[model samples]
Target: MKNRNVILTGAGTVIPWGAPSTDKLTDILRQDSIFINDKGEPIGEYLYSLLKTQMGKRRAYNTPNFESILHFIELLFEYKKSRYSMSSSFFRINDFFLIDPEIQNKLEIYESQKLDKRLDTSFGTKRLIANEYYYYELYLHFTFLIKKEIEKYETVEEKYHELNKSFNRFLHQVKGENGIVRFYTLNYDYLVPKISNLKFFDGYDEKTGKMNVKKIIEDDYIDCYYHLHGSFKLNFIGEKSNDYSVCYVQKNFVQNNLIPSNIITGYNKPERILNETFYEFYQKMIEDLIKANKIYIIGYSFNDMHVNAALKRALKKGSAKITVVDKCSLEDFHLKYDKIIDSNPDYDMNKLIKFPNTYQMTTEALKAKAYLNGLNDFLDNLIRSNN
Candidate 1:
């Protein structure tokens, strides 16, 4: 019997490849940003306040989330241009935008503390933002920072291979298998290709290098390799991409820009995941999850609700065996995910709590084998256990 296998890797997998952890990335973004408006006004005070913890609180007091902050910034870039509805005069966008609302009221009512401070203090910032020029600059900086970090995947040290012994063994097993194998990732880097020497189609046309998503989705026997999140290489270049373009463009050639770095980050992922080629990959993931006999998860946090929903749907069926490889102990991993799933009452994903397929990576297994700390830790435990 062929053992059909599905694998899902996350940003944690790219940590070995020199990608910054979320907290570190947050720090880098905070430390480096100029926080000055396009019109020469200093907005650093309020901008940093939004990032800081309760004005005087320590790092433990809810360290500001990089994803949430970036998402809020994206929202600010969009809703700053609020206007009276031309269609319906009674319904003003300002009603939704809170035109100069009190800071305390905003703090009490809105999750985005940065929004009102941004609107209240910085008139120049608000004006420049309303005109759409400042938004582009902010977007460019954030995207560029992310791009720089992921690009370091090429420069990662060879020593990290010590942490990858289990995966290497898994890959060797895969090499000998006649079973259907699928690989998917939530990372925005090309590390997948670097690790897996297998040739796989990723919806992009081989000759034109442009993606034909519809055609690829229609094909039945295409290699089930996909990037669940978009990648740095997958830019959509066109005049249409100008409105929210975060493309790498010359100062002179801004008009001829790619519409946003295709690498999906921050928030609003369910909607963003449907963009262009990712839609096909998303569909493929669902299909693979449903049909898979065994699933191997590497370095994923099950944090994405959209993805978790799909995974929960699959888990509810109680079929696929699961093996997770991460730096964390299985108990800690369960708690981390339990906190996420328990909080979300809308989706009952508690099925994952006792899924009965956590194959030999648990703390008990560690005790039986040896100390397995992280990806950079010794491979002795994993190698001996597998043998």
Candidate 2:
């Protein structure tokens, strides 16, 4: 009965479910759109005001590069942090965030060449540290904004109803439900569990109210969920939980100590994944990938190096086939996967691969009658095969 192997979905699969895509989120960030809080204050204006004030107070505004750096940091942090909320920073103490190669490279180059004075000065250091906290605060604001947006979708009911409808239609088409079709996501949106009734596990033992990755693996679970990046509800060590202070999943979020945001973002994503909790989640994903006979990627973009590496390793270790369902062209998709495949040349390049023949379809277009029928048929045939 375990005919079709695994179904891997990215943020794109949820587009029909009311989540923003990568391009849409980027478009939103480029604008000066005003989002209001429950208190009716314009949050975007407030964020800009805070950024300007913080930089000015630290005398970073005097530096020609300050405004540009601030803008870059805001955009960078917002892009990564907003992903989980729509679907979906900080200074670290400056040194913390700067450890990321991309952010660090940008800052060092800006400082060395563009700064009016040597960045080694006490004032420069204060400025860097100040921006760190400013970015962190901005991240908090974004979290609040996402929570507000999710509230607009009839909280959990309507959203989950929609998910169940679409996904059940999908499940009805598959050959068999024998093998567990695990959903491993980089998204932080907390809506997937409500949509499916299958045994949902995300490395945290809800029974104990702690993140025990081993207990998750040891359990006799046929179906398991892995949040490769992290989730909004669970708070990690360094993350700042929005005042909600309660995970949406807990029976009593107020009474129980919720897991913090155990996610990886910004430039430190790969580095943070090395931490114990994330490392466990990632290792387990690779394990599952190897066991799967077929892999179906729905909305994923295949951008993360860590994920790509795991997928490649899984392909090398097993004969699992791949199917990508996204708007990207076959060429583009192949190129992206090739980035993973080319990294390890010894692995066989040929395996059953399929994608949407129609290009440039919106998430809506992709879900249209023609495409959906084609997709369902393709998957059915793939799963029905006894080969």
Output the number of the lDDT-best candidate.
Answer: 1
Model 1 scores a TM of 0.69
Cα lDDT of model 1 overall?
0.54
lDDT of 2 at 172: 43
lDDT tens string, model 1, 1-387? 556678787867667656789777776566543444343333323444554534234334244555655654554544443453212223222113222345323322323223333332221221223223344445545665666767776453577565444456655565345675678888777665565546666666766766666766676444456777777665433112213323332211222222244666665676566544566788888877877777776777777887777776666665666555566665666554553232324333223222232333333321112121444332344466567
Candidate 2 residue-wise lDDT, 257-318, digit = tens: 11123344543456557643667777777776777766766766676788888887776664
The lDDT for every candidate, in the order shown, is 0.54, 0.48
Which runs of model 2 end up more than 4 angstroms from their true locations?
1-4, 27-132, 150-163, 172-177, 238-262, 343-387
Report residue 282 deviation for candidate 2 (angstroms): 0.9
